[model samples]
Target chain A: MATGRIVIDVERCKGCELCLEACPQDVISLADTFNAKGYRPALLADPNHACTGCALCAVVCPDACITVFRDVPTPKAQVALEV
Target chain B: MATLTADITEKLVYQRPDALADLYTHYCPGCTHGTAHRLVAEVLSELGMQEDAVLVASVGCSVFSYKYFDVDAAEAAHGRACAMATGVKRVNPDKIVFTYQGDGDLASIGLAETMHAAIRGENITVIFLNNAIYGMTGGQMAPTTLPGQHTTSSPFGRDIKLTGNPIHIAEILGSIPGTAYSVRRSMHDARHVIQAKKAIQTAFEAQQKGLGFSVVELLSSCPTNWKMTPNEALSWVRDNMVPTYPLGDYKVHEELQSKRGRGR
Candidate 1:
């Protein structure tokens, strides 16, 4: 399975919950506390480690607050396989 | 299974496009104006036209659009964006000139200017935002407001007999001979959002090739004016707005038609 991570800029998030809806893995949720903007920011609350980092949340985000990254298999693993 | 760490070998998948300013926009929560701006910025960056682009921001909620885009931009009078864009494109024919206008400004007050620019084949791009209601003016009934839709001016629902009808800008503009490309897209869902981006990219390509006037009418939402949450407002656009303003390509020049259906 693809592994991934996301960074949410809390101050920039307006807490519209669009990222949560866009997260197919259901790994995102709104924080209980409010930010300086008085809006609850979305968090990468993945407990089962199920995030695939599809970037759907970032795509749907209107505020441009989410940054997404995907893990790449190490070259050492491919070298060992060839051996 | 292995635990994920921040230090893992990773590739960045998505981040803010360089064409957009690194500043907070004045748009409300869930306002699709930010989404539209982001898409435009992405397109400009992908086409490597950011340096040559000049944005003409129109009045309404998007009046501050110039502040959001990092490229050279100018603020135009209410309902005069097309006229100003025509001037800018004529003065600097080599530059990529475009106008960002709202329905009230494009279809209502500046209808004549918009049509004349298109009819003249001004070789400019127009990013038209149609949110149905006049957002900056406190949700008044706009020319694009749907029939029976309630607003500040139409508290009892808009009456078609009195207000006439909601204008289908894409279709109207597409019929003009000078219009090289005209299409309507929505920001209600991720799938449609992707399609909207493609349409925006095509509109810019039309201008880049000097095909003539191109406009992409984006059906956007106004959560504050609609008195609904951002998610609900998006659903409302899908359920209500999509029917009145159907999303499809109203026109495409024969040259551009060949480029359609190709994978990105």
Candidate 2:
């Protein structure tokens, strides 16, 4: 199973709402909580399950705000006998 | 017999630009509008703003600019492209905003919008194409139309007593305090075309940096209106229009280094 992560850089964000529209899975939203500049920054909800790592959000972001990372699980290693 | 491979130059001519849509343009052959579209499209691709950029096209031969550019676009009312672009930029500040207009549209009907946008220092790129005549509306006199130049409206040759002299839009816009960068260029020949691309890239870079208003005035040729072949039309622009609309950087902000400098 793969998990998705959404990271945002609040400082560079201009509150353009482009990522909000670009999110096809509707996992991204803008919270009422304001950043240091008093502008509403984008917030991600249910990121682990809802986001498919489509990367549309990253592509449409004019200020290049959001970055999506897909976590792929690694295979387990076999134990060696010490006889 | 020796095996021969296709030369890179031959491949270059066969490869079509991906940024431009596969549609037959309505512009006349040898019209500079096609070159202008290609330049803008290439810039959008180079900056990776193709998807995020929204172009506002004004009424003119460039009104169909939306058809050629692969990016998102909206057709504005005649001469209202600047006003529409202002709204789009404000609403979606992140997306690259641009307005393409002709001399008549920018210097005449949309004069107020153009002046205000420059004065307010809107962070948008305006591509002003000055062919000196109203191309789509027939060979009519335009604000940038040279003095003593005959058109359909000025069949007896433009008279200073009747029709006023050409307006230097780039120079006038450069005088405004809010304008960050402005350049007047031409596409009469290969050399001028290269210079024009540089001017256009600068204008787009200014917008990307969120700098104030940027305008690139291109003194284009109108062969149909001039009643000459493509070559003659280009020669006429070089000889006549260059004297009236000299090519150079009218204004640039020495203090601003780049986009990072502006943001800081």
Best by TM-score: 1
CA RMSD (A), model 1: 2.3
- In model 1, residue pairs whose N, Cα or C atoms come closer than 3 Å (at least 3 residues apart or on different chains), thus clashing, are none
What tens-digit string does per-residue lDDT give for candidate 1 at B63-152?
999999989999999889999999999999999999999998999899999999999988999999999999999999999999999999
lDDT of 2 by residue, B142-239 (tens): 98888889899999888987766789998999999889888898877655665776777788888888878999998888888989866678789889
TM-scores of chain B, in order: 0.96, 0.92
Q: TM-scores of all models?
A: 0.95, 0.71
Kindly list the per-residue Cα lDDT of model 2 for residues A46-79, writing each as its tens digit. 7348776665555434333465776442222111
Best by DockQ: 1
Q: Across all candidates, what is each one's fraction of true contacts kept? A: 0.71, 0.00
Misplaced by over 4 Å in model 2 are A1-83, B1-14, B255-264
DockQ of all predictions against the true structure, Cα-based? 0.62, 0.01
Error of 2 at B160 (Å): 1.4
